[model samples]
Target: MREQFPLQQEVTFELARDVGIRHPQVSGSFQVMSSNFLVNSFDPALPKFVLQAKYAKDLSDPRTVEKLELEQRYWEHKNVPWFLVTEKEISRTASQNIE
Candidate 1:
């Protein structure tokens, strides 16, 4: 399951679906909160990856850290991974420069 901002919801969902399809035995869903995807793999005892999307600029922001902490606690409660997907700084800066 996957969900980013309203603008990237579809794109992120597609990505999550692609990942899910690669693992036929896995089953999970996109959460409404911090986690974009919650995957439950075949190994029940292993820690699952908790995918989240964020912008490059937000990476060093205090709010981003807070959100990460919250996501960690939330996913950890259920024993999940705190994987984050952030835009590449170089690419983002290049794009900004182009503009």
Candidate 2:
């Protein structure tokens, strides 16, 4: 079985609006998906996108590339924007950005 990570914190977000002479109506909400990551609103100033990351040593393998393509198609059908990434890319970027 795969090991699980410990929970460090929790946050909540609500998209709501008030109606005339009534309580606030919630249009939507966001929460941590599968307890692995936090969800946040996309910056309106930037282009809409979703980043899908995976850890794999074989960069030439079709599986890794296919997974990203599948995710891209799924999100596209839902009208959500997406981009593909990998674990190595994330680590490299983090290391470079560290002061």
Candidate 3:
């Protein structure tokens, strides 16, 4: 996620893979999909992050939150703004495709 358009309905992997494909030297044949639920515009200013708790429920867990917070603090201490994206959504999607 980067600089989200709050006006858009979805910010999807289709968009990212399209971007990846547009670059001559980049890998273009990536699989892309969208969350079946929310696509938020969080804060409108900081668009680099997209919160998908509803799409993958466990993200809202207290333990997961604590772990994410701890990891975030650790990264921030070292001046890194990294992401911890969900794998379940993609995994479930792949499984669905197989079915």
Which has the greatest TM-score? 1
Q: Which order, best to worst by TM-score?
A: 1, 2, 3
lDDT tens digits, residues 1-99, model 1? 454422233443444454442211225754433466665567767545666767768878765565465555555555556677666534767768868
**Residue 56 Cα positional deviation in candidate 1, in Å, after optimal superposition:** 1.8
Model 2's alpha-carbon lDDT is: 0.39
User: Which residues of candidate 3, in runs, are more than 4 Å off?
Assistant: 1-55, 87-99
Cα error, candidate 1, residue 93 (Å): 17
Which is better, 2 or 3, measured by TM-score? 2
lDDT of 2 by residue, 7-93 (tens): 211211111111111111236543222112222455775334455545556557765454344444444644556554566666766
lDDT of 3 by residue, 1-99 (tens): 323222121333333244332211226653222222223345656433333233357777765554345434433443434455555545776868868
Candidate 3 clash figure, as a count = 0
Candidate 1, number of clashes: 2
lDDT of each: 0.53, 0.39, 0.39
TM-score of each model, in listed order:
0.47, 0.41, 0.32
Clashing pairs in model 1, backbone N/Cα/C closer than 3 A: 48-81, 50-81
The reply for model 2, stretches above 4 Å from the true place, is: 1-39, 45-48, 55-57, 87-93, 96-99
**Candidate 1 vs. true structure, TM-score:** 0.47
